[model samples]
Structures are given as C-alpha cells and as structure tokens.
Target: MKLRHAMVCSSNQNRSMEAHSLLKRQGFDVSSYGTGAHVKLPGPSLREPNVYEFGTPYKHMYDDLRRKDPELYKRNGILPMLKRNSSVKTAPQRWQENAADGCFDVVFTFEEKVFDMVIEDLNNREHKLMKSVLIINLDVKDNHEEAAIGAKLALDLCQELEAVDCWEDAIDDIVAAFEKQHKRKLLYSISFY
Candidate 1:
C-alpha cells in the first residue's frame, strides 16, 4: 500500500506548501494544512496584518494585498508566492478543527508548536486511531528561503521512508533517523534570514 502524508505549518503559505509541492512532484500522496487562526501575512505597513479565513481563495487574497500595498507585497515575495499558491487550490486550514477522514501514515510539521498541536489532537482520539500515524517535526523557520530548504529536507526524509519495508512497524527507528537528518541539515545550513 502507498503511504499517505501530510505537511503542516503556521500559515500554510510557505513551509507546508513548499513541502507539499516537492512531495507531490515526487509522486507521493500528500496534503498540507496551516495551524493559524486565520491566514496571516506581513501587509502594507509592518503593523498591519493581512488575514484571510480558511476558505478564502488565494487569488482574492493576493489581489487584496496588492491593492492594499503593492510595494510591500512585491518586496516580500508574497505576490509571486500567492500566484504559485493560487494554482495549488489551497485554502488555509486550522489543524485543530479540520479532522482527517482517513488517517495519514505520516505527518510532517514545520515547528514545535504545530507538532504539539497534532500530538494533542491525536491523543484525544481513540487509541486504535492514533497508533498508526507517525509525526515528525522539522525545526524550520517561516520564511521563503527556509521553506525551500525545509522542502528539500522533507523530500529526502520521505524518500528514505518510502524505501523501507513495513515502515509503520519501524516508526521509532524512522523518527530517530529523521531527527538526526533534520539536526544535521540545520547545523550545516546557514542562517535562515
């Protein structure tokens, strides 16, 4: 059976989307989600928050941000990112509220907070429903550049997991390997921002 995966981050704009793209391109069954209350971004003024709800269309958000502050959107790479994101047919999803119909074989999160949230949610489920999923958290920053690197790390780890026979039975060993690789990547890579 093919393994199903999910990638999660704060806004579902940067890290999770990047990983989703890479994993899908590699022919893995993957989905991405955000854990934020609403989609949030740096807007025209640093003080102004650009927020969109879970179901808001990416193009709409892009256009609104462009209208609000063309210069700020352009400078932050939000315009191009939104353009690409729009093609993916993704809307923001709060992890706590969006229950999975079918459990994922593995779930990758971009930060500790998201990891904790996922763990808590899984813990709340029945024991049989929780035992099959493996959650791995990679400590990547919420920036475009770091997202790109995180995608690479996620892809490598997924590919490694794919090669193993009965990976579900080897969860602990696989997670340990993932953590070691994650740490090695962080140590070798330069500063995120």
Candidate 2:
C-alpha cells in the first residue's frame, strides 16, 4: 500500500518544501505544511521578515520578493525555493488550519518544535476516524543545504516504510535500523486522527 506522507517545518519554506519536492518526484502521495501562525520569508533584515497569510500563493511571494530585491532574494535562494514551491502546490498551508486535509500515514517534521506543535494539534482534534499516524522528528537546520540532505534522508525512510507489508507491525524494526544506519537520533510518536 502507498502511504500518505506529510513534511512539516516551522515556515513551510525551506525544509518542508525541499522534502515535498523530492517525495513528490519519487511518486509518493505527499503534502507539506508549516506549523506557524503565518508564512514568513527572510527579508532585508532579521527584524523585517516578509510575512504573508497562510493561503497566499507562492507565485505572488516569488514575484514580490523578486521585485523587492531580485539580487538579494536570488542570492539567498528564496526565489528558487518559491519557484519550486509554486510548481508543487498553489500556496503555503498551515497545519493547524488544514485539519480537513485528513490523516497522513506518516508525518515527518524537520524540527522538534514543529513535531511538538503537530502532536498538540492532533491531540486537540476529534478522532472521528480513529486512525493512527506516525509523527517523526529528525532535527534539521533550517537552511538550503540541510533541507536538501534532510529531504534525501526522509525519502529513504519512506522507501523503507513502503517496503513493509504492514507498517504498523514493522515500524519499530525499521526505525531502529534507520537510526543505526544514519547515526541520527529520531523521535517518533503515534497519534490518532
């Protein structure tokens, strides 16, 4: 069976988008989200972030950034990331606002704080379906290079999960092997939908 997957990060800009692009390319039934109140992108200064509502289109963000400071945005890799994001989905989605998206078999979060928020959100929702979702956190630095590497690692884990006949039965062994092989600690929990 093909497992539905989600990649989550704080802003849904760098890390989540990278994994979303890779997983979608590999033919996984995947979606990506941010666990933030609003979508934010780096601006000219640390204090001045480019913020947008959750449903704002990636194309609009791309165009706006390009118009604001093409060279700076391009140099910072924001333009390319937004362009890639536009091709994948229409806009950035917030996890809290998208409970209607239903349950994913596995939701991979790139940061611990995002994992916590996802869990908290799940806990607060009614579990009409009573379906279990595996939420895994693999701490990744929020940067282009780290996102790329984390995306590859996430794909490998998904492939491993896909190979199993019954994921719920084999998840423990799979996760243990993955941790041993990658030498990266992973935090995972099961939540109901």
Candidate 3:
C-alpha cells in the first residue's frame, strides 16, 4: 500500500527538515513537524538559543541569523540549514499545535522523546477516523551530520516499507530486518486518529 509519512523532531529545524527534504525529493507523500513550543536554533552560546514562533517564516530566520552573525551562523551551518528549510516549507510547524485534518499512515521520529510526544498527542486527540498510524522512533543526535545520516536511514526504511505488499502485515518482519541491518533498535507504537 502507498503510505502517507511524517518525519518529526523537537524543533523541526534540523533532523525532521533534513529527512523532509530527502523524502520529498524521492517523491514520497511526506510532511514534517516538531513538538516544541518554539523553534530553537543554536546560537552564540549553549545557554542562548535563537528562538522564533512556530509560524515564523524560515526566510526570516535565515536573514535574522545572517544579520546577527554572518560568519558564526555560516560556520556553524545554521544559515545553510535555514535556507534548505525555507525551500522545503514556509515555516516551522509545531506538531502539538497542529490539529491535523488527516492522519499519516506512518510517522517517523528521530528521538525517543519525540516519539513519546507524538504518541501522546495522538492519544489526546479524538479518534474520529479510527485509522491506525505506525509511529517509529530511531534515536538520532540533533546535529547536522547525524541528521543527514538519520535522513538516509529513514529513506531506506521507507523504501523497504513501500516495497512490501502490505506494511501492516509485514511490519514486524520489516522492523526486525531493519534493526538487524542498521544495528539500530527502533521503538514503534500504533495509535488511532
């Protein structure tokens, strides 16, 4: 079956967007989201993060950061990331804030915490459709390099799932094989929408 997919992370700036770009290019019906209250990007110090509201356009972030510290943002890769994000979508989206009209067939989260948040959000919503969504978590560090790696791994898993006749029936075997091949344990939970 052709599945609708969503990639989720904390801030929707790094990991999710990375996978979002890749999945969209590969022609998968995909969307991305974050569970954070505010979109946060790395700043000059660990204690200080450049924060923006969820609806703030990525282009604004890109320009704001460039104006703040062109050299630093460029060196840290935040500028490039914002540029890519702008190209993919208008702005960062908050998963919790989005009362999504439709449900995804499969949702992928880059961290266990994110997975928990997604599941919790789904549980809190009314199950009007009664459609089950497979939520999978693969722990990936919140960094540019790790995001890239995780995106590719996510794509691999998506391709594998798409190759199967019925993912719901073959999910167990597919997840097991994927774990064995990638040497990464995945946590999955099913929820209705």
> Model 2 — TM-score against the truth?
0.95
For residues 1-193, write the lDDT of model 2, one tens digit per residue.
Answer: 4676555555558999899889999988788888888998999999999999999999999999999999999999999999999999999888877755567888999888888988888888888899888888988898999999999999998898889888888888988998899999899999998
- Of 1 and 3, the candidate ranking higher by lDDT: 3
* lDDT digits (tens) for residues 69-177 of candidate 1: 8887888899888887777665656666674454666678787777777777776666653346667777888789999998898888777777788766665676677
C-alpha TM-score for every candidate: 0.84, 0.95, 0.96
Candidate 1: RMSD to truth: 5.8
Off by over 4 Å in 3: none
Clash pairs, candidate 2, are none
Off by over 4 Å in 2: 5-9
Clashing pairs in model 3? none
Top candidate on lDDT is 2
- TM-score for model 1? 0.84
lDDT of 3 by residue, 97-139 (tens): 6736757888889888888888898898899999988889989
Ranking by lDDT: 2, 3, 1
* Deviation (Å) of 149 in candidate 2: 0.8
